[model samples]
Target: MQPCDLTSTGGATIASRFYEPPGRPRAAVVIGGAMGVKQDYYAAFAQWLAAQGYLVASFDYRGMGDSRHGPLRELRADLFDWAADFDTVIAATLLRGGGAPLYLIGHSLGAQLPGLLTHRDRVAGMVSVAAGSGYWRDNAPQLKRMVLYFWHVLVPVATKLFGYFPGRRLRKVGDLPVGVVLQWRKWCLNPRYHVGAEGTPVREKFEGARFPLVALSITDDELMTERGTHVLVDCYANAPRRVERIAPADVHARRIGHFGFFREQFQTSLWQRTVLLLQGFQPSQETAA
Candidate 1:
């Protein structure tokens, strides 16, 4: 693993890590992480992909992890800024790919934002895990009330007082920049979430994503129910998309929640299946473009 930095939009530097495979690579992969999650969380997965003959790149978005160079309260960023950060990572991954096919393994917010990137065409295919519209109302019954409580009561008060969300201290979510937390809150409140909340241009951009996408949702994911997953995948209306809802029993596991897919324990079951998808193994779940 090699530490690196890439320039994002507005001249900000994104902290990144690269994993190189032992010989001629079969393909290159860019692993995009979920919100408030650091790049290190995906380190094991990147190394596994590298061992599978893939060149892997993973990074922390600005205002998070190693990329958070300054005070979070002073950081000026929004959803678009995150999209640009993905674009930067995509470009770097494409370069490292060296004419090999490039693929993206996006988790949660990681999968949701790539549609907004202009450089998305650089990717040949995508594997989205636990991707979903974060609308609080669509949250699973067990989590809905808590989600509403956080968004309605805590989010506003905390962000206003701190100028950013102190999620780490609260143990609610990871610490988030004020703009990101606020913008995400707005999206989650809207019925159409990403589409209706982001406005027409972004909606069009989402539909314009015409690449192949394999979206995987876990039945046990409390944060992203089946409906929430489809709400997100449906935005890429023009893509040749496949939706697979996997249960914990499918992999002989006790549970695989929104974040469980990344646990090293699934290295053989879930992760290997993802490797096949990245290798261009097409399943029958695709909808025609």
Candidate 2:
């Protein structure tokens, strides 16, 4: 993986890595990471994808990882800034691969925000991993138990007190800009997630994107519930979307929680399934582990 710096359309610096195969690449793949996660966290997966003949690009959103330049308290970025960073990586990946068909692999916030992308039509396919609506009402019980406290007290007090969220110190969602935390809180508190919280214009933008998408959801995800996944998928109303719900036992694992899907341990069992899906194959057994 070669380190590179990209400038978002919004002019924020985005730190990234490019993974290229030794031979001609089958396609270009861009990974969009979950909130609070960094680009390096996905290095293993990107390198493996490269070995599979897919030139891959992975990056960190502003205020995270190598992308962060200064104190979080001084950053003025919001979620939309991160979306712009996503588009920058996509454009760079396409240019680097000489306009190869591009596939997107988005995780959590990474998946949920693609509808905001400007070049939605250029995308060949998308793999939504652990993607879901963040409306607190639809959250799983494990996370629901603390939703009230997090939304009502923690977010409000923390952001106001520090000019940013002290999530790293709290061991919560990691440090985030005040603007990002406030806007995200609105979506999670609203029943309609981003669409209802942001209004019709945002929903229309999502509805305009057309692509074949596969959404992977694990039953053991403590944060995203079944209904949460359903709501988020519905945002891409015009896309041909397929939902894949898997239980840990089905994959011969004891626990494949919210983040385990990318672990090297599941490369053969779960990762190859993603390869077939991106190749547009119709699995004979669907999702037989």
Candidate 3:
């Protein structure tokens, strides 16, 4: 792993790391992380992909993790800024790849936001892991009520009390700027998530995505329901998509919850499956353009 910070839109710094393959890479990949999850959280996965003869890149969005500046309250950023940060990483990876094909491996909110990127057309395809719309109404049965409580009570109260969400201290979603917290709260409350909450403009942006996407939904995911996953992926109406729902038993696991897919123990089973998708995946007939 090598440190390689990037200059994002508006000249801000995005903390990043690069993993070089042992031999000449056949392709390159960018591992976009879930919201509030640091780039470091993806270090193992990135290294594993690099070993598969692919250059890999991972980074922290501005105002989170290693990219975070001073106080959280003072950092002003919203979804657009986060999208631009993702674009910065993509632009850099394309340059480093030296004409090799570039693929995206996105987790959770990372998968949801790539449609907002202007450079998205440059991507060959994407593997969306645990991707979903965070609508409280469509959340997993076990998590819906708690999600309602978070939207109705916690988000407003906490963001107001601290001028930002103290998610790191609360051990919830991780520390977030007030703008991101409030904006995400709106999306979670809406039936169609961000597309509905933000309207036509956002919908058009998602429709602009032209590559193929394979969405992997874990049955035991505590935060995402099957309906929610479909709803979120449908936002990218123009992209050829194949949504695959996997059960824990299929992978011989007791539980493969929302975050367990990256635990490294499943490297041989889950991670290897991911590498195959990155290489040989094809869109199913129903979703083919």
The alpha-carbon RMSD values of the candidates against the true structure, listed in the order shown, are: 3.6, 3.6, 3.8
Model 1 lDDT at residue 10: 92
Candidate 2 C-alpha lDDT tens digits along 1-289: 7999999866789999999887777788899999888877788898888888888999999889999998989999898888899999999988987756788999899899999999788888899898899999899898999998998999999998999999999999899899899999999998889998999999999999897788998899989987899899899999999789989998899998888989999889888888888778323312211
Q: Of 2 and 3, which scores higher on TM-score? A: 2
Candidate 1, 129-218: lDDT as tens digits: 998888887888888968888998899999999999999989988899899998999999998898989799989999888878999989
Clashing pairs in 1: none
Q: Please list all clashing residue pairs in model 3, or write none if there are none.
A: none
Off by over 4 Å in 3: 281-289
Residue 146 local lDDT, model 3:
80
All candidates: TM-score: 0.95, 0.96, 0.95
Q: What is the C-alpha lDDT of each candidate?
A: 0.88, 0.88, 0.88
